[model samples]
Target: MSSLTVLVIDDEPNLVRSIQFSLNDQNIGLHAAYSGNEGIKTFTTLAPDVVLLDLGLPDQSGLDVLAQLKALSPDTPVIMISAHGDTRTAVKAVKEGALDYITKPFDIDELELLIKRCGEQQRLSKELRFLRSKQIHTQRIIGNSHNIQQLREMIEQIGNSAAKTILISGQSGTGKALIARSLHDIRFNDAPFIEINCAALPEQLIEAELFGAERGAYTGSVQKRDGLISLADNGTLFLDEIGEMPLAIQAKLLTFLENRVYRSIGGGKERKANVVVIAATNKDLKEAVDAGAFRADLYYRLNVVPISAPALSDRTSDIALLVNFFSEQFAKQEGCKPPIWSDDVISQLKTYPWPGNIRELKNLVERITILYPGQTAMPKHLPNEYKQNPASSRTEDSNYSSVVENKERELILSALSQCGGRKGLAAEQLGISRHALKRRIQRLHIDL
Candidate 1:
């Protein structure tokens, strides 16, 4: 919450004074240095949040000073200020790790905006580093089972390889998206990892969303849009529920995958995007292809580096670790002490068939953490379904089936209400598809 400090390194006294006066009432602390040496010394001592260095300095070359500053603190964001004609020097500074560069006589408002953006970037970078460090300490793939170990080894091998197109197949809630993210973060941490759920968007909008649109491409188009493909250039694009993508869009995506080129919805020029595509789906692509629901060519292309995320039921040995991880995570979020998981609770959890996989376990842990923080969790603390035998619980008791059906109905209704009756949003919240939700509604005979 402290005011962000900015260090300016420039020789022009008038310019420095003007900058200082301009930012005096802006709630930002400004420090000025007239030469490169003074700037480096002040930078080392003060450790400002952002630095504005002039490409032309009095004592030493600004590039050298920038290099030294980066060597000292690589995380600090440094913006270069140069004369209008010194574009070459600005480019050089940027190549040498400068965050960005601005020409002289820049608008004060624009400079302030740039400084704020730099500060936000610094904050996000710090948070990402913290998360990465924590992940290193705590395995992202948390399981000691042989299948899990082999899966982890495969992930590492694929991550280290140069495979661009990857296909991740698993059941719903088995952490396919997590595996996709892990693959992206492991290889390209500095780039964006954009995710798009194919089933979440309607057929009318998915194409525009993927390939972008011009101002007049559609009814609501008021401005030109850069789609996920363009935005994910030089990064990774995760296509979730890839089997649900419309057949028409599948062809376009296939073309893009083949050539890395795509055209906007209503544009003439072809745009290029150098991106890695990681597609995931719970449905079997082979089945979809055989049924003519998915393109065979696209499936072959994306299956270059296939990886399967194991279901939680298959990796029951990791139940305790995952429980602790989720419990501690939820406890931190709720500002409470983490719960102690008794052996009985772990055994109970290990026995339950997690139909929703890791996601279900995480939700259960969060629910328990919120309801019984700082207490020891035993088998009795679990939900009734988990406490009962899996097979007999569903088949033997009519009341139990009724209770589950009522719960399902309530969940569907709640999701629909929360989404303002938007079927796509409701389906996403319920972790199902719009078509599936329609079928459920018809089967339940729920009145809208």
Candidate 2:
């Protein structure tokens, strides 16, 4: 194991020197503090891997110190150092926050073992956080369209700013979550990225899951647990589908967003977490607020830096690029060579309005790669839904127009007729901006 940085808080110079001497062979960096205040100052600065806090301190009780340290960085492991007669207090320290305790007349070997255990556990957790980031790394936002370029610039600008709370608004499958991860990678790459879907968790349990709960706070509560906010200290906490969050929880969330302070369920000491909150939602928050389903105050608080994830139809030009990327990705994932995509298939894909966006596009590529590994993939091999949508057999009539132009006309008319000639609703179903739909209508010379 790598050397562990340990902060020892005790008044005994002789005992401190003894520990330093005994752990000399371990190559550890030891910081000594003879009093509680000194220990806190050093802890706030050092952020050592593990702490050996004395249960009895000269200036104040150690339990109070433990609570402060926990509020600052809950993930940091701490062990209690107590005298033989203070054994009961040591165990209570464990309940308070300490990972383990060693009564004085402590064996040096046992102390070394405890330190190593803490180091190993922390090493594992770091690895897990790295793996989570790695998974996001593989799913890069791939596109070169104007909207994508603007979105990229926005991420860089917002990431560089001091804004702590951001609201990501977009339709489902439009890569709102991807945009959130991109923002996280920009600023908090080294720190943990904790996320929770507010809509996925049960209404009864959402509060506890996000803010945590004290022991016996709920029916199944067995032990005190830290919330995602605490876990994401000095990092990013992604609240997905935030519009679906309950009204009561929205008020509590607003309090935390404003001050970076929160209280757990069953209410313990108010804890502070330095976390950048990135909230994503598919719902129209303004509409939801007006409808009395979402809190207005919370909505405004979270919208400090609003980000919109563009739908696929807004960047139809990038579909070919995305198709190539996904095909190569899924082919490698399936342990097979990527199938050759015909130009006809690419053209057909570009013509069809992708309502499900990139996610749907990715699924299509993955499915095709699995079924036809090395063969040439054509429009014929594609799903009938893809072929039947806009590119009907009538595109060949010379009196009509070019295949691409005819296809666009048909798609717009189909969407328009289905929505009873409502262009706004049709534009939504087509996954394009209202302006894009308007431009298409003018270009296609379609009658109302």
Candidate 3:
């Protein structure tokens, strides 16, 4: 802690020397400035942890320097010093964002104590920021349904094995990444887990980026580069959308898997990369193999362990848990009060067929929070597609017209109820964004 830096500004040379002598060995490096101009220059250059500013400076007022420093780095604590004591002046300093102020004849020990307090507060603020960012990825599978429980057990079983390859099959937005992270956290929490979206990467640069290239290996290769695979050595590598990998690259990757070694483009040396591979895909890889797209040999290698993630529609009972989790998460992120999900709204959420799975659910919660603001979520707050559509929830019935009349009546009633009998608000709520809500009420023949 002795390496911590403190910048001191004072017009008096004797006072500056006295402070340096008093605090030299107290876990802080001292920097001195005699004028406001010099103080600003030093503060910008040194980026000190704390600043001790004198209110009276030769070139400019200390308040001016304090304001400038606060604007530059709001987190650095600034303590003001002044000889003339006035309530108004102290209040003004505080308003200008000064952390604290001390008189000219202050004791050395008192000044040191103030500085230490500021340091502790700064450290706490940094830690809080880190924890907030960390929680976004620290979550586990938040469900209690039988399907999810079975999936968890299978994940644990595969995680304890020594198989170097694993494959995860699921539809888009089915929490594939969550399952992958769970497997990694179970086995290699201490080691790095690198992830790459194979579909998002361009085919040309995928090879060089995966396997490192030597200096002068290609036209733009000015320095030797270590690829993501090298970084994942002795760890796990997750390749998402593996079916999108180009055929040429697939052939090279197959070779690399057979012999734990790969040659970079325009380089002759074979680099050894020992990494456990976990690949995920929404496409049917077996169909791709049958069509001569994905290599059959690579498919067998990746099939050492296989796990399938169930779609959200197959497990509607988990919607409430997911909604609550997302609502709390979004509320924290937005810094706004979390909205309440009324029982009616929750029932409506359960009735909808979630085509996009968990991702879609998260998106809907965020949108609901935005529209409802500080109020509770209601049926009228939902978008047009999910407004009391009984037909949409029919899992076995293929007859659409049989349920249309009941759905339309329920939707109009819900809209009117939420809009307080005002047809305009009801119409807008129903996404009929046309004529007045009264006109909609008359058209739907609603009594309200």
Q: Number of the top candidate by TM-score?
A: 1
Candidate 3: worst-modelled 10 consecutive residues by lDDT: 130-139
Name the TM-score of candidate 2.
0.57
Question: Each candidate's lDDT (Cα)?
Answer: 0.82, 0.81, 0.76
Tell me each candidate's RMSD, in Å, in order. Answer: 21.5, 28.3, 19.2
Sort the candidates on lDDT, descending order.
Answer: 1, 2, 3
Per-residue alpha-carbon lDDT of candidate 1 for residues 26-98, written as tens digits (9 for 90 to 100)? 7789999999999999999999999999988988988999999999999788899999999988876865678
TM-score, prediction 1: 0.59
Clashing pairs in 3: 423-437, 424-437
lDDT-better candidate, 1 vs 2: 1
Q: What tens digits encode model 2's per-residue C-alpha lDDT throughout 1-448?
A: 6888999999999999999999999978888999999999999999899899988888999998999999988768788988889887886676566767888898999899778766654554454344345535323777668998788889889987888999999888999888888888878659999999998988888898888899999899999988898899999999999998999899889999889999999976899999999999989999999999999999899988999999888898777667766776775564444565666787788877787888988878876775555455778887666785664532433432254467668878998999999998886566445676787789778989
Alpha-carbon TM-score of each model against the true structure: 0.59, 0.57, 0.57
- Model 3 lDDT, residue 149, Cα: 74
Which parts of model 2 are misplaced by more than 4 Å?
Answer: 1-139, 391-448
**Which residue runs does candidate 3 get wrong by more than 4 Å?**
1-139, 390-448
